[model samples]
Target: MATNLDLQEQEQIDAVKAFWGQYGNLITWTVTLVLVAFAGWNGWNWWQRDQAAKASVMFDEMDQAVQAADADKAGRVFKDLKDRFGRTVYAQQAGLLAAKVQTDKGQADAAIASLTWVADEASDEDYRSLAHLRLAGLLLDKQDYDGALKQLDAVKSSEFAGLADDRRGDVLAAQGKPAEAVAAWKKGWDALSDKLDYRRIVEAKLTAAGAQPAASGAAQ
Candidate 1:
């Protein structure tokens, strides 16, 4: 019985060795890859958090500059944020805030530069739409009708479609294309949700432009 038991144990050991021989490298490689991926994920998360924290500090600095109404300082801090932490949310916020300061300070060129960066580089679609919309308005103020229309054309978010068409109408009107303006305004009015008071404002524009407004049930 002892000899029989020894033989059975040896057979079991040999079976395990055969299995290991066939799958050992695959198992080893899979485990090694899993560990490396886990480590890389953790490292990437840590790096992102570190970057955001530093970017937040710079954003705060830009905010202070904006509050002071110091366009120069805001622009400077925004440049630093763009250079060092441009991929962070704080950097996008800084660009928008600094642009606002620059606009208010009559620094149109600086405002345009900051807004252009946000329009081109903002990761969030909503932010990109916002930047493009604001940039359109700035271009309009400069009487760059073609540039304004181009920016409005670049707005991709459906959420901003009504606003974009409204701005497009404004640009067309400024360019002495009253008929085109009316058409654009009609689209804007049709796109806006009835719940929005701004929709009514667009409706008024349509009426004043001697165009009939599209009928819609009033928001309950």
Candidate 2:
């Protein structure tokens, strides 16, 4: 019986070895590919973290320059951040801040240039929408009605739908299109929540444009 058992075990070992011999290379290669892919994913994550860390430090420097009211220094740092990490949220935020500083210093053209860059190049949709809104407002202040309307039209976020509509209404009103202004304000009002105090402002705009507000219950 022991001899029989020994022979059976030997046969089983041989069967396993034969199976492995037929498929060992494929299994090894499959495992190697999986491991390499996992390692590459980890490496990419590490690289992104390192890049974000460096970009964050530069953003803080830009903020400090802004707080100090040093426009030249802020502009220099912001330009560096944008050139090096334009895809970073911090870089986009710095651009907005720098544009505000430039505007406050009577640099409307420079402010528009900065805002235009962010509006066109920001990786974040929300940031791009914000840049377009601000840029449109600046252009409207300069009475560039067509340019303002174009900028407002470029805003892409549904969340900014109300603001964009309201801004568009303002532009249309300025251009003596009261009927279009009222229609835009109505759309904006309908998008806003009933509880929002801002809705009242839109209602007032519609009223001023010789348009009647929808019934209070109709503002869905």
Q: Assess candidate 1 and give its lDDT.
A: 0.92
- Note the residue pairs that clash in candidate 2: none
lDDT of each: 0.92, 0.87
lDDT of each residue in 1-220, candidate 1, tens digit only = 9999999999999999999999999999999999999999999999999999999888888979988999999999999998998999988989999999999999999999999999999999988999999999999999999999999999999999999999999999999999999999888888888889998888888889999674753333
Q: How do all models score by TM-score?
A: 0.88, 0.77
- Give, for candidate 2, the lowest lDDT window spanning 10 residues: 211-220
Candidate 1 collision pairs: none
Off by over 4 Å in 2: 1-22, 142-144, 193-204, 212-220
Pick the lDDT winner. 1
Winner by TM-score:
1
Report the C-alpha displacement of residue 49, candidate 2, in angstroms: 2.5
What's the distance in Å from true for residue 103, model 2?
A: 2.3
